[model samples]
Target: MTTDMKQVYAYPDALTEVEMRYCPGCTHGTAHRLVAEVIDELGIKDRTVTLATVGCSVYAYEYFDTDAVQCSHGRAPAVATGIKRVQPDTIVFAYQGDGDLASIGMAEIVHAAARGENFTVIFLNNAVYGMTQGQMAPTTLLGQKTTTSPRGRTAPEAGFPIRVCELLDTLDGPAFLAREALSTPPHVRNAKRAIKRAFETQVAGLGFSLVELLSTCPTWWGMTPLEAIKHVDEQMTKCYPIAVFRDRLAAQEGEQSAESAPGEGE
Candidate 1:
């Protein structure tokens, strides 16, 4: 008798065997897996370098199998810019959270994008700070309650949440910018596609590419894993709509295709 057994899924080679330390309901693990899968699929594991920033993802260096550098709190972009400049041939990327990217490292990211830095950025926006307890982050939604905003985030006092993708869209440096959630299977699949495109943008010598993932911190959000997922789908998406804000490479490809058409303006 012959028996056949098929392997449905397995961990990507781009990820180390280190066990994840994220909370049980947190989505940082999911985001890390997607990025690793993209790196593995692109066959760039050996040439890839990651800048792991502070916040909940401070330990990213332990998860990704590629070479990783730990940057000061909110300084991943600055560090990544230096790495990419020194090693242009290497595929450089930064993994950052809302607290690290949109809060203190805002200037670094803005300047990097403005300068058209050649690198990839994986931004995880979970609305609150996960490392130092549940504090209100720059991307914290209005009326959202956290340790810092126990009474709920209010206007004038707490100010409005910073829309990173839309904010970067106003700049003319980035070659690609997109946002996706990781609440469901379809959403997770789309997130992987966006991440792959971001990496490809860098390989094509395009400008900075950022893919913001709307993730969840169930532990900080005071909700179960399932509730956190639902919150990402039903609530977080309301503030940060999933869409591609920019794609210079795609635009250029379209233009090229149009020019090659058999007939035009006839």
Candidate 2:
């Protein structure tokens, strides 16, 4: 320890000491830490619960220091809905990958958001199904290669990459919806902010909230970490376009106060 040097970042107590099983350069572990940090920052570690269904993050319970549940594939949203309803004060969040979320869990997520479930969803979109040996996922980009799609995904065969944020933005029940990237340091910071806001939305009882993170899969993508991150920046962002699709409560209180002021003055 050096007296003059300051530690800019410290491990969150909300995260366990378990070694992550994700491949090198995989961004799932980074995303997990951000959620754990948010829980610690909000002083909700004791009351927070994380749900992991399937895909690469199925062992999420081992890494997060808070309460955790392993749900059936694509069923985390359903489980989270139940938890939040029965124990409304608890902070419930589901950590899901594209294959587990946007594929088999599509109906569950859509209906949950439509019903305005008060919970947060941390979605990881690495463009391929990393757990299943690099198969094409719902978020797979056009012409992206994978073990299942050896010749690259085509429009006719795979349709198109699902823009989840855009799809959910059409619904009115969501309190917040955002898409962010984890390719680099700056982008990771932005992603963390979005994750925090999503959790805040749940805590405020606003409604269903979700943050989609564009991550990397260096092993499955057959590229170095640098190249994978570059691909996320140059290609995946073009398809997903990092943006906050909706925010229900961040500014409404102040705006409502200001609006009432004018009426009172009158």
Candidate 3:
């Protein structure tokens, strides 16, 4: 037995031991790990509740070790809202895919954010409905082809892809809003950080918070695992720039700092 090797990483306790069934190379598992890691890091595993929505992640309730609920398509925000209100101290977060979130549940999410619901949302944007045979989703990049849009998404026919973080940033309710890609190691680390920030906002009793993760669906994209991740790193990011659109926590901290600064000649 070699005693020199040391383990730097271990499977997140918040994540279950169930075998992942996502398509090889898909980033749903990566996103799941990031969320689970945040749950673990926040020491909220006992109080965490995950609302799993329809789409590829419909069975996500089985993957997470925390208390989870199976929500109707596009209704995760509504369910999460109810949970957070009933048990304000619990850490609640919704896991949703692009179609489940940016499409059918659009109204639910918008209103929840507008009301400043004290919860978090972990949104995965793969640009297509990977579970339902790769239909064009609300976040699908223009000119990207899907089973429903075999000719590529056209501006006239499909309109432009929805940038969720940017849209939510326009609202005053959210305490945090950001987007990150899961294409490479560095980007994955950043995605985890963004997720943690969203969780932190909820822990601080701030308003709505969401982290949109640009994910990969290799099977639907007609690419190998490596190719799918590359596509996200290159093409998909062009349509949705990775950045923090809003962070009320950071803003409030900045304001506090300025207020405490010595005035004039101290």
Candidate 4:
């Protein structure tokens, strides 16, 4: 008689054995794992460098096994650009939150994308300033209540939420732009695929690539983990639809296929 074998999931080698500090129901941990999994899958852990931005993602360096740089609020893109320029062979990425990227770092990201900086940007948009006590963020939905907008964000007062993917799509320099949610199992799988594509864009020497992850902050949102997950699907997706805004590789391939069509020579 032979014994049956069982296979189980294991921690990614790209992630360190350090304990995570995120609060209960926070999806930052899941985002981190996804990034780490992508790095492991791509076999780039040795050459990968992560730029950890301020706010909720400030402690990312302690978790990722690769080289990490701690950037000031909204400065991760600028820092990442420098790192990639100096060491072109290394795989560089900046992990930033909505409060850090869409708020204080907006100019940096736009300029970097405009210049076609070759790097990956993982933007975590949880709709609130998680580390700063749930203040209104640039990506916060209209009518959403936050510490700064307790009465609910109004169109006239707060203006509409900034759709980062849509805004970046208008720029001509970025190689890829997409948004993914981390709410359910299917959403999580899609988020991982987007993250992998972002990394692949950089690996192929493409220009700027960004994958915005719609995440959850249960503690700040004052909801249970399940409720927060539901909120991401029901509320956040309304303002920020999950889809690819730009894909240079796919466009190039389509052009090539068209040019080589059998009837083209006729």
Where does model 1 exceed 4 Å of error? Answer: 1-3, 259-266
Q: What TM-score does candidate 1 get on C-alpha atoms?
A: 0.95
Instruction: Give the alpha-carbon lDDT of every model.
Output: 0.93, 0.92, 0.92, 0.91
Error of 2 at 201 (Å): 0.7
Candidate whose lDDT is highest: 1
Instruction: Give the TM-scores of the predictions, in the order they appear.
Output: 0.95, 0.95, 0.95, 0.93
Q: What digit string (tens of lDDT, one per residue) describes model 2 on residues 183-203?
A: 988999999999999988888
C-alpha lDDT (0 to 100) for residue 62 of candidate 3: 93
Residue 60 lDDT in model 4? 95
Residue 174 in model 2: lDDT: 91
Error of 1 at 135 (Å): 0.6
Score residue 225 of candidate 1 by CA lDDT.
94
lDDT of 1 by residue, 1-266 (tens): 23686665789899999998999979899999999999989999999998999887888899999899999988888898898889898999999999999999999999999989999999999999999999999999999999999999998898999999999999999999999999999999999999999999999898899999999999989999999999999999999999999988899888888888767545
lDDT of 2: 0.92
lDDT of 3: 0.92
Worst 10 residues of 2 by lDDT: 257-266
The residue pairs in collision within model 1 are: none
Model 4, runs deviating above 4 Å: 1-3, 253-266
Per-candidate Cα RMSD to the true structure, in Å, reads 2.6, 2.4, 2.5, 3.0
